[model samples]
Target: MHFDRKNYSDKILIDLYEALLRPRMIEEKMLILLRQGKISKWFSGIGQEAISIGCTYPLQDDEYILPMHRNLGVFTTRKIPYSRLFAQFQGKLSGFSNGRDRSFHFGTNDYHIVGMISHLGPQLAVADGIALANMLKKEKKATLVFTGDGGASEGDFHEALNVAAVWDLPVIFVVENNGYGLSTPSNEQFKFKSFVDKGPGYGIDAVKIDGNNVLEVYDTIRQLAENVRKNPRPVLVEAMTFRMRGHEEASGTKYVPTELMEKWAKKDPLQNYEAYLLKEKVLDEATIKKIRKAIQNDIERGLEKAYAEEMPKASTATEIADMYAPFEQKVVQPQSEGKNKKRYVDAISDGLKQSLEKYPELVIMGQDIAEYGGVFKITEGFVETFGKERIRNTPLCESAIIGIGLGMSIKKQKSVVEMQFADFVTCGFNQIVNNLAKSHYRWGQNADVVVRMPTGAGVAAGPFHSQSNEAWFFHTPGLKIVYPSNPADAKGLLCAAIEDPNPVIYFEHKFLYRSLTDDIHDDYYTTEIGKAKLVAAGENLSIITYGMGVHWAREVMESMPELSADILDLRSLLPWDKEAVAETVKKTSRVLVLHEDCMTGGIGGEISAWISEHCFEHLDAPVMREASLDTAVPFSPPLEQNFLPKGRLQQKIKDLVEF
Candidate 1:
């Protein structure tokens, strides 16, 4: 089709006008709602509406969109019902999130809109995965991700762009350079004059567009999206725009200079487009007035519907909470029966290999898992065995790795993501806490993903490399945490995790990786999650431990044979076996909890409190806990040993045995 600049009936121009106005009306209504206190908060796309709406013209219904908080424009232009969006603001049952998520956090699986992460930059990685999945599935869809210029400074943004470039995924990263990120302006936050400058380093095509010009954004994005779909390569589109309003309802224009604000207001995309439409005779003054009035009426009707919509009942939260609801249980037989019984690492390799054999959709990705077999060689020869298509190597982007895993999981593929070490998980905290952990709960969807991190301390690797931070995730809701203390349990739990429907954070203690010798069956086996195991039977005291602490406690038990101690290993922390712990405490009438993590807010504390509340009458002495000190793990062997819970078991044995 030849470009027709003078024709008002030109298909591209008409489409652009429709897209821009749709979001503009939504933004105007949102502002009114905010002022009336009908909506608690809102982030406006007042001036940058053209970029979001126009740039997305080429996207099909099957294509994925991972937008940021300021994407009301994109959603509105994409035909998401304004009533549903307003219901979200009111926390109603009819909202996209069913009242589980805040107003800005919206997602619709039917539309292939995965949802927005309130945190910045992480969605870039998520978009990469969606694009990668499209390529793998042989789908014609492309993935478009949007973020502000300020978000480009985040580590995840860089990580995701790099990976997408290397893999040549069908991704279009749109940077809405809307002058400011909250109160911080782009000039102050970024060192580069334009975000597109960094795209060359990642080997991706990059372009900067006049965000205020709807035609320019529409043309550029359409061409880029076409090229990306054909070649399945990544591209970066930097849309230079301006924010016409404060960041959110809570923000004020106190910090913004008056002259600068006036300049941007004069360059408003909506006003510019309105003039263009009038000058081109596409719409006369009467027609323009009619369109404005119609949009106003639509907004009013949407607001009325939203206000009348019922809020999600309290029972709804309780019902959804029932999914992760705790259950009471006594010691049950460990559920491990499989085709291959081998060491823990062997079990992992076999399970993954078997999964690949059974389901071609399974993919294993991490830093060194491809050819290096992982840091611990648990995935040794996976790349050569499974081929690069299934076993892929990722950059040193922890957040991107996990984020991609989440996206792939959402696409119905079993993705196993590994962190080089558990200590480095902090880099991916946003992906875990904000995106993966809460995705299911907030969006009423499931992310069948598995994240494995090698954890615990004993190798004198120091603070940065040697630390157990499971407590951080134990407190996080909607995440299933599993720690295996031995080879059998590790293999069994890993198998279970891969098959589960929810997100699982599987922590493999490095100290226990090859530390024990056990005869495992050669068949596939999976242990039950949310259950604890009774390793030994005793009468004096109950010792509750997990991971490497289980081994240390056992040694103490053997050393002090005079003290008959019962040992319980809690493999799962979030939905821990409270009933098992209570029963054991009640039976032994004394308890001692041990863990490798820091003492404060450790799993031991939660266990101790549960026992104290439920089995207080059965106790012979106060519940004692043995855990690492609050300080960081030391490099010196002596200091590290002293910082750990090595002597707690012996002391507990003597004290409890005497009692």
Candidate 2:
């Protein structure tokens, strides 16, 4: 086996041969465990050995790798310890996610591996963020991302590619064109033969290669990786391979024909590469046998050690996980001390401005965010102060931008992602609910992303542009939903959201942007989350509301000067001020919950339900909820006003008080 070291000699050939064989053996071990009921599932890279090994081996240890489920070779090539790898499969405490993720859906900061979620395309944007971090650090390190041909059809794939190419990021996207995506073949999934011709559309270099040929894949990817580091641009390499097995071991290959299966089996990467090494005299029969024996022994010992490790105790699962944590408030007095009369828009801007000054690495990204300062002028002059790098104007891809923010949040910078309009958040909803909201719970990953959503009707922006979507994320755990009432709270809460370790969906009322103005604090202070502000304290009735509803409740209370009533502005939605609501309900003996979002399934229902359960004895009347009628916001101004309960809050409050 011994040979020259300077070139691609016998020793290097044997090393490649061994690396290729290790993942195969590990999958075999996992399959046996699956049969024995020790493991649940197996996603084996049975036939795509060359594509994984060649593309991975060239990258430096510092460069991050965002791998998919079938990338067993990636873990082995990156030197992820076999003991921990087996422990993960067995759902033990010794694993990366401490049994939270029993599959290959686990990643670690230590290894710089951003593992996949079940949905394929989201990790592409995450990889983009990793490369963006590298670029920001002025490092030449490249980010390698792996996805299947089917995942290429995903929005995340397109969004990630566009950002990488547009920003000129150092990223090598290796699309393992393994003919089949789950059970669907490429013929039905894609219109193009391969993604090679598609890279130019996104301003990236493209290459197509024989995925089974280890040497060819290695040489091509190595050269591309070097060029990416030097010039810093996105490159797409489509490696054509075949899935010799089903999507998983449990999924039998009944859909695949026997002839097609036989054809790919003959062109097996490991088998072909092993023959190549033998022909090149990299190893003789004895040496090959010894290598195989050694690998088996090493795997057995690691597997034994992994099996002996303890499982995560049910009582202590969330010990290390950060979820639903309370906000820690800190007041910082301004050194110069200059207060300013500010509109709601100005307060949000100043809050962001103060946060930017506080944390220089805070990145603000969205459409029209750079020069235009957002469509509503919330971030005007932020680009000039923070520079273009910090204030990023992203393309109209909602999902990827949030995906990019998540990547940055995990890897380096604290980020605030604006949706342009709250309604458009549906485009990026998966990234928010699945990735951002679940990352902390799944793997103890910190999602320091603040999504600024401008919401509410009454601006005549119509359905697509105007809508309150707070209820969409109310059901998602690991998210902090803060909808502020006024300028002071808006600024203070934006700062607080940016500082929080978890994900915050900050809903700023579009109606309040210019309509609400007051003298705001010049210094930095975070308004406490999960706490209510007592706007007008009274004894007759209680109005519990947030966003534009808070002001409406106040207006309704003011209209009736003789009837004193308590108005509690719920600043946060997900962690709503339950204590304040209960106390006010007990004192006033009645409650009126309101919001701009539609009536059915709105957050108003959640509040009403909570109050009914907790304050049933204290209440003098059932909780009356006043939300917009269950319908899309109309374009007609008269219809829109009628659709929203802006003019009806007075009557709703009266009904609760009279009851």
Candidate 3:
């Protein structure tokens, strides 16, 4: 598998040798450290050094690469200081994620690298997002992303390829078919002949190469990447290689056959490549020895310095502050009030329109959200005004689209993603909870993306479409949840959510979209995110609610004046107004938490627990909760009406007041 020596310069040949040698040497040192308990784990990439070094060497500084756990060459080749990377491996304060993430789990924007999460598939789609940014900016940049033979089996892999092909995005997917996933053989992982064979089904160009051959990997990837950057389409390169050691240092390779291991050992990437370099007279034995000695010295110094660095402190205040990016909730009241009445849906449209006009970096993505508008028609006439590039319609792949938006955010592009229905978000739940929610805290990366959720019940849209699902994301940290009750609040809260430098879940009640109307300002204005609005103030008892529950409480107050109480609407759920809740609780000495979600695991439980713990002395009665029945929303109108908390709100308020 020797390549022609005449095709490459001496510098390129020498540079490739250095790249391949560094990771193998580093991994060897790290394994010794792991045995001494200096580091907790190591995934050795001894035999497959050629794939990472070759794939990474061809890319420019501005182009991005997303690498997996075993791709140690990505970090070393990118010229990240060896000391800081060792500190990251040791969980020291000086690491890239400041000790928040470890090993190859962390990413640095400075190196134009995105690191993989333990769930490997999401990063594939995330690469699409990076390429998407390049396409929108009209930049001739290609995104290279890596995944194992095991990871290629994930749904996100297919979705990512389809998305890149459909949009004609420049993304080079490098599948390192290392013949095993952990202890599972590649034969058990997929039925296809090779990953390259499946590329045509996605309309992507494909190639298979000897991953153990450094020359072939470098030349093939370099040439293919050039074409992709020029033409802007996804291409798959299957690099056939094998792991020379266990998946992790701790996971022994007993499951692998002895003959197969021996067979792969003969084709060792670094060993064979180094032999060819010496044979071709690229470097003398003295120079080779000098290079090895230099690499070993660097590794020793890096580990020693990293060990001396201080460990990260577990300060409560600092930890809490680091959970979300700093955001100031400010309510900008209109200078001159003018009555421009509109339905809840219309107000959301206005807010999005204004956001689009205000921020040129803003892009909206969803299924049928472009020329067809959204299923709910929230983005009607938007594509005509904003154009398809900004008002993008995405595939039915929810996970890929969400991950794509996160990728775009990484490139400083603000994105607004509309979940076709609140229930449909389950498909993208891992991306939201695992990737998006953990992005900021994992690194200093701000996921400045708004996820528009059309939520709530009472429309008889059945179990799948009509459930009140705000509670799902409310429990997850590093996310902002905003649920508005009326048109003005809807418009204002949406504006605030879009501008906030955090991942915001903006829930628009499907039932209230056309049912409610109010006077919204013609000009843009923002309602404070964490501030609660007092719809009706009274002292008998307090009814704390949000979204449709606000209207339900208002109805109870109007119908039964005897149940006079302070009705506080908590517009934002994550950083909900604790001060206002305390004030109302202390004022009335009684509280009733209400929501449209099912009674058992709903937000009402968390609210009541907090009230019980913090405002214990102020309570004249136990904190009461009124929520929908703990069952799926029914299709029958009668059962649906009975399932909602609105039917029993008056009685719940009466009991709280009487107590």
Candidate 4:
């Protein structure tokens, strides 16, 4: 390969050498620490430093980069302090995640980098979001994202590429074909000729290059980045390399054939690059030796500083306090002078309309949500009112859209994603539970993304379409869940969820979309999350519920006026109003927790246990729970009615009140 002197000055060439050398030294030293048990684990980028260094060298500081675990050169080339990087490895308080996460699992906003979670494919969609933000702002910025050969096979990889191409997003997808994915070889991973061939299927242009040659890697990435920046379209680059070490220090490379290692050893990126630089008279042996010595000394000092740092404090209360950002629970008062009767679906539309007016950067994304106005028509005429930029339609790619929303949130751009149905959230479950739910805690990045879930069973949409799935996200930390029963609360809670800085799961009951109506206020308002609404206050017993259960409880109470029972509508499941629950339980002397989800593993079980533990002394009877039967939602309407607890709720409440 000929060195392109026109593109690289001697100074730039030497800098690239140092950039490649730094991570090599860091990994060499870290492996020793791993053996000594000072560090927990190690994922070495020993032979593949050129790929990370080369790909990152041409990027502007403002252009975002999302790197996988093996891309240590991305951190080193960005000039992250050796001390902080060492502290992160040692799990000290001085690290980026403040010891909340370990190894390359953490990301740093200061460097315009988003690190990968264990699930590697979601980051590709996240990169699409960052690229989307750049395009929306009309800035000349691009996003560089990395994935392995195995990672390319993931659904997110294909979904992200297809969407990026469809939107013409400025993203450079780099696939490092490192021969092995953990222990599995490339033969079993894919049947295609190469990742480059897979790109054309997604309507993307792709090329292949020698990843071991730093110059080739740098030139290829630089040219692609410039073209993408000017034209704003995604391109793929496949870098051929080999992983000389195991996936981690513990996972030995026994599955790899011995001859393969011997072949790759001769083609080491650092050695070959150094030999070329020497042959080109870029630098002599003395200069190379001096650079190595300096890097070693720097590593020593960094390790020493990391060793002196203290571990995170041993306090559960402190850990809990830092789990979520502080949100001001605003009190909203209803207007008494308006004739504003509205359906639940209309109220949601009003809330979204109001939110778009308030937040300039707010975007709403879902399948057929643009001119077609979504399956429920909640966004009817929204594209004309808000423009196509804000009210956008998405492909049936749930995981990619959620990851894109998260990526937009990373750049301080708020987004709202409506799952066509609550049950469909299972398709995007990994991105939700692993990425959105953990981003805030793992790093200081708030996922200001609201996921609107059309939930509950009643319309005979089948088991796949009809489900009350709030309990799925209710159990996860770093998420706020709000389920509203009527139009007023629906609109108010929707606004609140949009305004919240953390990730929020906003559950809209599909059945209540048209079935329930209220005189909702015409003006913008916000219902406080973690607050319960007191409906039909009484002294005999308390019916604690949310979503469709609120309507069922209200119906049962209306039919049986003789039983003086109060209904507590828990609007928020995660930060459920413990104060309201206690007050209501103490006042009524008996409580029944109800929900539309299946009986086992429902949110009602947690509420019932909480009441038993805290309000045991004030209770006149045992904490009772009324929920749907523990079985898949029946598609048949008659069977569905039997499966639901609504049919027997009146009798169960009567028994509890009598007992």
Q: Give the clashing pairs for model 3.
A: none
Residue 617 in candidate 4, Cα distance off native in Å: 0.5
Tally clashing residue pairs in candidate 4.
0
- State the lDDT of candidate 1 residue by residue for 151-266, as single tens digits: 78788888999899989898989998987878898778987888788888888889998888877777778778888888888899999888877888679767889998898888
Every candidate's lDDT: 0.79, 0.85, 0.90, 0.90
For candidate 4, the 10 contiguous residues with the lowest summed lDDT are: 330-339
Ordering by TM-score: 3, 4, 2, 1
Q: Per-residue alpha-carbon lDDT of model 2 for 352-447, expressed as tens digits?
A: 998999997788899999999888888888888889998999999999889888888767688999999999999999999999987876676778
The alpha-carbon lDDT assigned to residue 351 of candidate 3 equals 95
Clashes (backbone N, CA, C under 3 Å), per candidate, total: 11, 0, 0, 0
Candidate 3, 98-189: lDDT as tens digits: 78887888778999999989999999988999999998998999899999999988999988999999999899999999999998888799
Each model's TM-score, in the order given? 0.94, 0.96, 0.98, 0.98
Off by over 4 Å in 1: 1-12, 316-341
Candidate 1 has an lDDT of 0.79
**Stretches > 4 Å off in candidate 4:** 1-6, 331-339
